[model samples]
Target: MRTVDLEVVRGLYKKAGAARLKLDIAPRFKPGDRVKARNINPPGHTRLPRYVRGREGVVERDHGVFHLPDARVAGQDDRPQHIYSVRFSAQELWDAEAPSEDSLNIDLWDDYLDSA
Candidate 1:
């Protein structure tokens, strides 16, 4: 394995730690669109949090296209897709006793969601 020295790390994070790319790919969702998180459990690296899987949320923002981290980790590079901020009510993720007015926003890739 190659060691990442300071110079290499500096070049890798030149964008201030953002992997965002300059692409014109169309987004799969938009704000106000209801979506459901796909219950996927691949036998490999994934950024999807377990608590949010199979939950419903509203698309809050389109963060543009970027390479899927999971895909990259699996050696399938070039899998670029739109990432969105999805908002879920605390009650939906937890229980009815949770505050109804409270919601949590999590950034999710297009592959992780479907129209609700």
Candidate 2:
């Protein structure tokens, strides 16, 4: 199935997509909102990994604000997103073998979480 119209449309999109762009990102939450990492898997992709999913964590810090990523990169979305440092106990992220006296600092975007 070859369609000249389809090919032309695709080529036009490819040309328009080469332009550099900028965006504005807004903070997702206040200082104390609780959020959990998203749990998902897709073929041929590298993400935050499996050990941190579904873990309960607190918003320990905020990094002001920044622009969200876009289709040019993985998990990229052009939107205002807040960044935060979420803290999780080592045991929560890594079960039995996790050390008792340590916690992990995970930097996450606003879209990567929700009220927990």
Candidate 3:
């Protein structure tokens, strides 16, 4: 592993705290595209919400490319890909508990989703 200079990082954050990377990668899922979150159970760090796993949703918008923490935390190669805001209906996620008129929008990585 390599050491990251804290001061250098801090200097860059003087303007904004945004972690969004400027990459010219093509987005896998576009707005209005139907998608499903992958049902995964890895014994490590992940950003995927447990409740959203195995559930289907629509891509609300693409948030551009960023490093996938799952791979990095596993001490593997970094896979930077597009992250998207996906909108899931309450009925689809919570069944009968949540109101049918309600919905949830979650930011998810490309690796965590599949064409539904």
Q: By TM-score, who's the top model here?
A: 1
TM-score of 3: 0.85
- Give TM-scores for every candidate, taking all chains together and pairing residue i with residue i: 0.86, 0.60, 0.85
RMSD of each: 2.3, 8.7, 2.9
Which pairs clash (backbone N, Cα, C closer than 3 Å) in model 3?
A: none
lDDT tens digits by residue: candidate 2, 5-110: 9777778766653432334555666667777887655444333556767677788987756554532255656455566888888887877578887899887767
Off by over 4 Å in 2: 1-26, 42-47, 74-77, 96-101
- Model 1 pairs whose backbones collide: none
Q: Which stretches of candidate 3 lie over 4 Å from their true place?
A: 1-13
Q: Residues 29-99, candidate 1, lDDT per residue (tens digit)?
A: 99999999999999888888999999999999998888898999899976899999999999999998998
Give the best candidate by lDDT. Answer: 3
Task: Give lDDT: candidate 3, residue 114.
Answer: 96
Superior by lDDT: candidate 1 or candidate 2: 1
Supply the global lDDT for candidate 1.
0.91
Which residue pairs clash in candidate 2?
25-80, 26-80, 69-77
Count steric clashes of candidate 2: 3
Candidate order (lDDT):
3, 1, 2
User: Whole-model lDDT for model 3 versus the true structure?
Assistant: 0.92
Candidate scoring better on TM-score of 1 and 3: 1
